[model samples]
Target chain A: MATEHAHVEEHTHPGPRQYVIIGAILAVITLIEFGVFYLEMDAALMTWIILVLSSSKFLLVVGYFMHLKFDDVRFSGLFFAPFVIMVSIGVVLMALFFNLTR
Target chain B: MQYLSGIDDHRTSTGLDNRKMLMWAFLGSDVMFFGTLIGTHLIYRNRSLSGPQEEILSIPITTISTFVLLMSSLAMVLALAAIQRGNMGSFRFWTAIVCVFGSIFIGFQMFEFAEFAHLGLTPRTNLFGSTFLVMTGFHGTHVAVGILWLWTILFASYKGKIHQGNSLQVEIAGLYWHFVDIVWIVIFGVVYLIGAYGAEGRALEEVHHAARAAGIG
Candidate 1:
């Protein structure tokens, strides 16, 4: 176990510089998301755009800043498995509520 | 660099450090927790029976707050990198900045909540008010907790407890902080932008009705 842990630690993680670049990209995406609110597009199109932009920001943060991209794949599974399930439940609930309300 | 001193101490059966795995497990569960709250808010959106609607939501203010939170995530990752590299000074510096940015985000939330209350939109006022308050209130609680967690880690580092040899301590905290930031990203998109847009449309309809009844349309 000790040798295995040492082997894992031997791998290099990104330095401060790369972290800054990732942060810059995240900040740009966030600004674009805010800008979407002001665009005079179709409401459905605007919603899709916002979802795409925000989800992009979400993936960047999770993959880079959280170090999941470099870490063991198990870590990603640990976090995202429940995320997928939760999102499914949320969508189903939203559908039910929309139908009932209508 | 003394990297081997405390590095191999706590390997679990899965070859991952126990602390990191625990944090991921906790975050996985938190996904469900926040998912439910945000889903409830979305389901109840625009069910308000009276005034003080979503128009009271200032996107400019929330935009600033959202940016602040995003920058805090940057500070969090930098702090983790500093600790891993055994740079205590830089770690403390970045962690302090993270705490400050977290506090600023919370300050924006407090001001927004108070503004809503002043506009007569309390939890008891309407569906929008209730769900909005509960959802954002819980998120604010998470931010407040993160602030306290960062401070605790800062204090521990000062006491010579957290160093590069045990960078996992800082890594766990960073995971929690980053999770909180991502959750806010979802809330900003779903609750603030989409929910508020719906309320704005309803508020416009109300204005139109008032104008028509007054023969001013």
Candidate 2:
């Protein structure tokens, strides 16, 4: 158990400074998302841009702020497995809705 | 055999700490829960039969609220770091800040809800109102619960029950808090930014026509 735990701790967890930097990046992404709302562009292109920006922000919060990047791989698997399935289901449902609406 | 670190001292047979594992499991389930709610909101978008949908959603206000919640996540991580370092003062300070920011986020939500009600938009008004309120309202409930959880941890730290050797308690709470922040990031993007943009655009067009009618522009 001790050796197992030591192996886990070999991964470096971020300090407060790194956490603050991640937070700043998240804030900037959010600002850009809000600004993009007012920009005149192709609606589809705008949607894709917002989705990309928001996903990047999401990854940053999960990776750094949640410390998933530094934690045990098992932990990441536990979280991301369900998340990926959920997102896949969401996409399927939205596609169905689009089909019906069209 | 000795424990690897003080935080990992309570590890289970899987070599992972029990509380942290449980928190992750719970968060995984929560991801599915919010996923359904968000999908519902998106499906019902623009399906309102009556009542205001877009004009009532103020992007600026929500943007500010989103920033507040993001900072709270930062505060939460800082608190976890401080406790791990055994700095009681810094831990308590950052924990208190997290609670404060969490409460401010809730306060903003409450204000928005009340203003929406004032403008005659209620859950019973239309499909959009029902799904939107239910989804965002539940998310607000999660934030409120997180605020209370942080306050409890803050009080525990005050009693000296939470220390460097047992920082996992705060670490788990921080995990939950960050999850809530991430959910709001998605909501802000899907619901507020894109969901309301079309309605707001139409509203702007109406204003333009009114101005032209009055010979003001």
Candidate 3:
């Protein structure tokens, strides 16, 4: 048990400074999202841009804040498998339901 | 033994804390659950042929709420860090702030829901109302549960039940709180932002093509 814990602690977690930096980045991305929301561009283009930006926020939170980036790889495998599967399912559902076209 | 670290001292076959592993697995399954709900909302988004559609959504207010939730995640991590460092004072302060922030986000949702209701939109109003209310309503419920969970942890710390020696408690709560925040990230972008775009008569040509393909246009 001691050895296991030592291994877990071997990965250096982010300090408060890193967390504050991450929070600021998240806020900035959100502000950009707000700005992008009003941009007079193609709806599809804005959607993709927002999706990319939001995905970045999601990854940052999961990686740094949640400590997944520094934690055991097994945890990442467990979370990402279902996450990928569900995202794929969402896309397929959208395609089928919307009959998506160019 | 480094008991002060947040990692549990328990031995597991997977060499990871069982409780944390269980939480991750549960979160993975939750991803599918919410995926279905969000997908439902998107599928039915443009199908509402009634008044009080997505255009009635107040993006500015929702944006403020999103920012609050995001900050709460920050506070949650800070709380976890404090507990790990045996800084009980800082832990309690950050934890309390997290609860407050979570409550504010819920308050925003309640206001938004009431405003939508006043505008003649309810679950029974149209497909949009049903899917939108159900999706975001569930997300709001999760946030409420997270608030309650953090409050319980705060109260427990007062009882000496939580400390650096057992900071795993705070870590678990932080995990749940962060999950809730991430879910909102997806909701804010996909549902509110994109849905609003579609509702403003600026929907993608594919939307019209889809509508025509289905003979709804």
Interface RMSD of each: 1.9, 2.3, 2.1
The candidate that achieves the highest lDDT relative to the unseen native structure: 3
Tell me the spans in candidate 1 whose CA falls farther than 4 Å from its real position.
A1-11, B1-9, B210-217
Worst ten-residue run, lDDT, model 2 chain A? A2-11
For candidate 2, write residues B1-217 as lDDT tens digits.
Answer: 2224654556689967888999999999999999999999888777665577776799999999999999999999998888777788999999999999989999999999999989998999888789989999999999999989988888887787777656778888899999999999999988888777777777677779879999997
Ranking by DockQ: 1, 2, 3
Per-residue accuracy of model 3 over B1-217 as CA lDDT, tens digit each:
4553435445478767788888999899988889899988987866877657878888899999999999999999999888877799999999999999999999999999999999999999999899999999999999999999999889999998888777776887799899999999999999988879756574445568779999999
In the range B88-164, model 1's lDDT, one tens digit per residue, is 99999999999999999999999999998899989999888888888889989999999998899999988998877
lDDT of 3: 0.88
Lowest lDDT sum, 10 consecutive residues, model 2 chain B, at B1-10
lDDT of each: 0.86, 0.86, 0.88
Best by TM-score: 1
